[model samples]
Target: MTRVNHQHSKGPHEMPATGGDRPRTDHGHSHHAPPRSVEDHLRAVTELLGRSPWFGREPVRLPLEQAAGRVLAEDVEAGLDLPPFTNSQMDGYAVRSADTAVPSGLQNQHEQVDATAGNPGAADSTESLTSLRVGPTVPAGHAPDPIEAGQAVPVMTGATLPPGADCVVPVEDARPSGFHAQGATVSVPAGQAPGRFVRPAGDDVVRGTRVLRAGDRLTPLALGTCAALGLGDVLVRPPLRVGILTTGDEVVQPGTPRGPAQIFDSNATILRGVLADAGAEVVAVHHVPDDDDVLRALLAPEAAEAPHPDLWISSGGISEGAFEVVRRVLSGPDVAEFSEFLHVAMQPGGPQGLARVDGVPFVCFPGNPISTWVSWEMFLRPALTAVTGAPSTRTEVRVRSGDEFECLPGRARVVRAHWDGEVLTKVGGYGSHLLAAAVGVNALVILPPGRGTVPSGQDVVVRLLT
Candidate 1:
């Protein structure tokens, strides 16, 4: 396996010089210092993740269509203006504003029948000639001849406006109606101002303007802007590669026959979805038995083989149990340096461990389904976002508990709860394995240590889970 460029950093379990003054409770007895705070452990994990090579590496070119939902690696400037040329905003008559500057209510009552053809019966009226004769139509995609001084051009919507035309009168406003079969005459509205209903070049966006900046996520709208700016491809960062391993002989695959103590493995499914939601590309997923030998053989590096994943996220076998396969194997000389494996002053997810196995970062969590889920949200989610610059999945909101709630004396409570826009209500009992209580919970109520019971209507800090 290709070894990651490992960095030496202090583990979360290492106590600071000031920690010696704090008291630690062991087996109902107060000792020298308390367990590490949640923020302290989170800081250490973030530090480790920041040293990863794939967190924020060099950029790679990708097609614009495939760059959606990924971070842009460089600023993209527009090559041409949005409109590229002046165009008509409506399918109507394009006229010079000076020709339509007549006052409102000026009527054109004189009728004409080709005076140039020598018809004296048709009287020639000067001031009564308020209507201008419509010129040739300017169809879309076909250039039109330049408009004359006293003439109006019939231009369709999105058609290029002929030179010397300053405004467009919608087809509905024309006296003779829209483009006609025979030659048409259009009435000019009074007080028609310049630039009215005319989409000028470079109005929406100018050429060479910075349209999209580096580190911006290529959302659907952002990608559309890139396409509009004449870009077919963009530079983006690749997704993080991760390997998931779920342990426990008692946990069998779904749809398989189970013995008396075996149950369907839900951790794998839950963690797979969780890692994907965190923007990690899960390259490999395996269900290893409680045997240490089988686990070691599958992970050992082979000659001329490809590198392992950038990171390994394992669930179960890290807790302090008799048959902890992961702990038994990684603690040996051949595999890794097991750094931290202690209670984290939090409920539902108290057991946690961090190690570097075969130069690949490994983060082990408790076996319980609820604990594994909570640990990811509480710790791994923030760490990944900080290192990889992924979007944040958390939000803090103040909420009032619906009923009286009690918390553990020394451990902080991260209870699954529901927030219905008004008040937050606690879910089922506080067992670490109570997976049923986690359903439909949009928030996690965080209660600090040393609190017995909180009365109803008290405001509590909660992390949004949606």
Candidate 2:
């Protein structure tokens, strides 16, 4: 495990410790808890995710065509050797190498040794076996009869090698080219070695060898490999089912009319796309208001009859407001366990929470659009990736800042920025609600905590989002 170093202490986002059951207050709105470091929060989230019911579920078989992008759940062994038999690697004549020997094919007699495995010393007593007559041509797909000791069989590329012929001499190398009827003598050149131009059986993959292992995400190449091994179907893990809920009294659906104080809901839409890209199946997406009773009833088991999601994700209503519906309704011991609701040492995504409602995992994000997006990228993406063996969500690059960069002294700053393959420059202001500018950028510049200023051209760590 890679150890993450995180500084945990009282920072700007923390409120005075709220003793007992009292809610911590910040600017008159009740707060959840004190702050934790980003690393600590990620560790907590990862630990909780490790306990999920689907972690070790049995694999399900799916057709090879439908298995792409799904994680392989079982190791696949090849049933038969690749190519399945010895075959010609070129358009050539299958011939015994001794017949083409440089010393007129009589070396075996002098050595008194056998070269052929099953037939011993047959060449020792025979006449110089060169310039043999051509036998029947062996085209692809039609198996040829066994070749006599001194004869050459014409074979095409990918044609199976005939028994008693240990090597192939290309048609170009044989005198009087092109395959002809029996008794037409074709001279084979010497120095043509055995096993040359022959694709030996199991050269690519041997039977009983495990070619594909569990936890591998099936790419097109991986699927093709399984098909090459003669697999009609493969065992794969199921995509995670997630239920997304976006809440706030002032938030409305995008297509609906909005009042003066209301804004179009972007959290649900953004998260749905992010989760889908991460190989999660978004089973449900809903908008919830600040009314606790209405929200509770909608989440109750009776209301959720079908399509139970494996996980639940919510944005807004997790911060320090009295009208925090998710906090107010589900904070009790009876409903669910709200494990940690606190600020992390990170700007734009400081507020976060985790819960378990009716045995289903729930993750809560702050209301700000950019903050919600950053939280998903930093926390949920990595944890889920570890489970699914999906490719890494972020691409890290060391870059120099194009200009002077500013950061909050006590909190790590994740600034939306544009990276031009060389230098990174911050885009828009450092406000969490600046979604318009956020969309224009392609990466995030992660500034560590307690470092307020970065001089121009200073090296920094960058995480590519696109």
Candidate 3:
């Protein structure tokens, strides 16, 4: 129900169409409708979205390194506390918290395989460090000679605790030469927290703790947590693949310009980049002349991919034009028909909306340079949240309109705009053909139809692009 205030600017989706909403195909004619508006189109899509289902997939194990941008497939429970052992926090000394002072490496020579996961039938096979010699100056991995009673040993960072040692004193706390050859020991103040300076086995994440859950995105921090737990692989959901179809007779590949009316195809390329940035893989983009049969054949590639894209997006064609995809798809009586006309009431993108043909989801955006771009930002972007596991829309901010705006009287207006840190200024004259303006602009300001112009300096909400 939001309105655009700009009255002069128009986008391609404000296309003119007859009763059928199909235009002249052979002639490559455009359409224009007097009744529909951008607001109306947005409403229609919103209705369709409410009925759409979320993405679906099963989990599979992937290396933590490769899990970025993937959704967690299942809940991950910790196999053990992070360090899995009583270990030193510093390179200095280990002492019994109660003893106030102790010998270092009293049990440094002891090395044991972790058998915490017990084999009940073979308890004796479970290796545990019961006794070891106290060591002085023992490196972290090597074992020291057994400590005689009341003896201290040298230890280093990551060294195992000697038997009966409960705390570690940082080297700074004890003089380096103060020890009698036992890797230096120092006194502790009374009541230092037990397990102080020690990362308790499973303290970061305890054994059997649910560390991650299904639906969680594999972010950098999340990967770091998994790595700390010694995980090399993780289970995550499959990436969403998308099919991009660019349809039109006037469009030709870049560097192959023909007549003045023949423009290079920027929509497909732009759409591809946007789709990828949104986390949906562009499985393929099929370029087709305005023909129904040709499009169906082109969609074959999209269908061939292991998991078909949840959504199919086509740029251009949905008006009451002969070349419109919506019209051609709905032409057949063999179960694939778009029951609704291009009936959105919004301007510039009024002709754009969703359709169901043979149960495949499709959204159509206008072909005009700016219309195509605007349509995606307005309709498809929000709907993509489910497909990509990201938010439905990009970030938006409120800024002062640099000039009073006049838009179509009844339809909502979307104006490509530029936003500096302090203000949002309108871009080049609002026309679908103004590609240069669209390029310079970082956002589009929505002006609800029927609303009066907002004077310069008035606050307006602007959706960011790029």
Candidate 1 — which residues are off by over 4 angstroms? 1-33, 55-58, 87-95, 102-162, 166-183, 187-189, 197-199, 303-307, 392-412, 415-439, 442-466
lDDT of 3 by residue, 1-466 (tens): 6421111112345443233244333211124435555545555665554443224445568898777766787887887777676566766555555443224555343334434333344445423232222236546776444333433345577766565666655654443223335433333233334576665666677788898887777778888888877789987766656667776666677677555555567778878877766656676677666566666655544545445555667777655554475445543444244445454555466556456554556676767656777777777767555444543357877888877776666677888788887777888886776765566888878776666677898887788875
Question: Which one is best on TM-score?
Answer: 1
Sorted on TM-score, best first, the list reads 1, 2, 3
Cα lDDT tens digits, model 1, 1-466, are 6421110112335332211222221221122346667887788678766655475456789898677667777888989998888999998888898887754554443433233233346566322233778798899888878888777888999999999999998876665556754256666555578998999999989999998888777878989998888788998877777788888667788888977767777888888888777657788888877677677776787621143477778888765555566665666656564445566888878777777765567777888888888888888888887776664448998888896778888888888888988978888778767775567778888888875788899998899887
The runs of at least 3 residues in candidate 2 whose Cα sits more than 4 Å from the true structure, single-residue gaps closed, are: 1-34, 55-58, 87-198, 388-407, 416-431, 434-444, 452-459, 464-466
**Model 1, 320: alpha-carbon shift in Å?**
2.5
Candidate 2: pairs in clash? none
Q: Between candidates 1 and 2, which one is better according to TM-score?
A: 1
Q: Which regions of candidate 3 are displaced past 4 Å?
A: 1-61, 83-200, 255-260, 296-309, 320-335, 343-348, 387-450, 453-459, 462-466
Output the worst ten-in-a-row residue range by lDDT, candidate 2: 3-12
TM-score of every candidate: 0.74, 0.73, 0.64
Question: Total clashing residue pairs per candidate?
Answer: 3, 0, 49
lDDT (tens digit, per residue) of candidate 2 on 321-384? 5556666566655557545566787888887778887777888888888888889888888888
| Cα-based lDDT at residue 272, candidate 2 | 85
- Sort the predicted structures by lDDT, highest score first: 2, 1, 3
When 1 and 3 are scored with TM-score, the better candidate is: 1
* Ranking 2 against 3 by TM-score, winner: 2
